[model samples]
Target: AKIKRVKGPYGKVHRGFLKGLTLVWSEIREVIREWQIHGQSVWVTGHSLGGALATLAVAAFGEEAKPIHGLYTFGQPRVGGKTFARNFDLEYQARTFRFVNNNDVVTRVPPRNLGYRHVGTVLMFDHAGILQTDLHFWNHFLDRVVGRIEDLGKPGTDGIKDHNMA
Candidate 1:
């Protein structure tokens, strides 16, 4: 695959992710070739930070690359800005599945306001559970990391708890 820095609205990304991919590209290609020699399919998966890396790896593989089967990511934060996201979505729409907990705080980081965007189909989970309605220092943690559900219609209560892996 052609190597170049992938620029995003917020900043350049090929330095961080793509550079890493390039460093190992030869080895990865060799591995894939070896796998293909045995008629094996390649499927990538990761969670949290690993998911972000997997997303980049798949992109580096190129859209039409053979032997790569699909990607499945969990609680992956935004990896790049709109352009990268758009390209990734377009290229891998049929194969990428991004699973995000409804309120996973990590998924909301490097916010869109900062020009970061998410790619792939977001498989959101809105699991029902008791919520801690009262505000607390752990509100974001509880709502997102703990996956609790407050009463939806209650005054001052919002269904903000939905971020847990559970």
Candidate 2:
């Protein structure tokens, strides 16, 4: 993957993702073109790191992303700064759906202090299994592969346990 910094309104972005998208874009475009010819709609979804890639991909696609049936991402880290977020929101017009487990800690990263801001409508999953905006910064490290399941699976688990996307 090529790693060149692409300039966004607020800062630079991961070039590897952009390069990957460029490499695959022709195929994706062909598929979408065929689907559109058949009156079908396009959709995109991703989780964690993939979510960031999906967001970047959609943004890079620009107008091509507008016709997508939906865009959903889970446990995504902040992708860019305020300017990038603003531009993405304007271009996609709420088409992106950022799903955050309110307890998940990963969502808070690249920190706002670093100028990273999220784009699209944030659909937060509160501790109650209901959607809400109540988020805690300590919930991002619930990865099963990292042995967090033991603590997370306990009865009445709160705090970090709630961060598990699994």
Candidate 3:
């Protein structure tokens, strides 16, 4: 996907993700305002591609009259570059939880080398389905090794299998 600089505080993000958000933002904003009017906090969540859009939605809502209560995403890909990640983290790090299931491949792209990066705190589930917070790289590496070995007989790669929401 191509990167484009949005004309707001989010810095540069994935063009496709930005376009997806733009297509539905007005409706989403209206719903959020309706909820806020009733004194309800607005929490956003999505999985995979939707996750990426959810991230942009929260950032877009940051300057609105009502703030987003929280954001949660699953198997989300990198949405932007360093500036966007840093800015988003500064604002919503405590309010965002990004879940990665085992070796879910979606979370690792569009490749840091391409200047894309993920925002929010990561809460990962290892191969044994045990939840881990802020796991060290060595520990994460060993877990992936174990998962791949266990998945040797499986039809698909562990990364792809792990991406399943189920």
Candidate 4:
């Protein structure tokens, strides 16, 4: 996965995601416009890699002065850098919800060390499958420990299992 600098409301974005959006942006924009014309709200959603593309699509719509009703993503990876994240949050944070299941590893990348960051409100499901919002650091750490312990007899890591949409 490569990172590319883009000249727009989105300062930097995942290259692959940008390419994917470029391919279908016209149709997506048209659909949104049609929905708006019919007095319908446009909400976007996706899981994993599709989530990244959905984020970029919303950003594109915002740049074009199109309003989006809301966005929801499951087990989504980071799609851009700090600037892009800040911009996205500024424009859409109130209407965006990111759902992370337990230790789903997909939500943790591209790493913060690499300047990638997540945007919007996070609604996480803990190791016990309990929904958590605004979790404290200590609580998050404890849940991770519990998840690892529970994975002791499992064939694969909890990260993969938690990423399952089901």
- Local accuracy of candidate 1 as per-residue lDDT tens digits, 1-166: 3223365323344346555556776887788778878999889898877777778878767643654678998887777877787787777868888876656667775567766777777666543433333434365355444333344455532322333466
Steric clash pairs (candidate 3) = none
Per-candidate TM vs. native? 0.66, 0.69, 0.93, 0.94
Provide the global lDDT of candidate 1 against the true structure. 0.65
Q: Which stretches in model 3 have alpha-carbon errors above 4 Å?
A: 1-9
Look at candidate 4 and tell me the lDDT of residue 72.
98
Model 4: per-residue lDDT, tens digit, 82-101? 99999999999999999999
Model 1 steric clash pairs: 103-162, 144-163
| Residue-level error in angstroms, candidate 4, position 29 | 1.1
What RMSD does model 4 have?
Answer: 1.6
Ten contiguous residues with the weakest lDDT in model 2: 139-148
Tens-place lDDT digits, model 2, residues 17-112: 456566777787787778878998778888877887788767766744436666799988777767778887886746788887645667777677
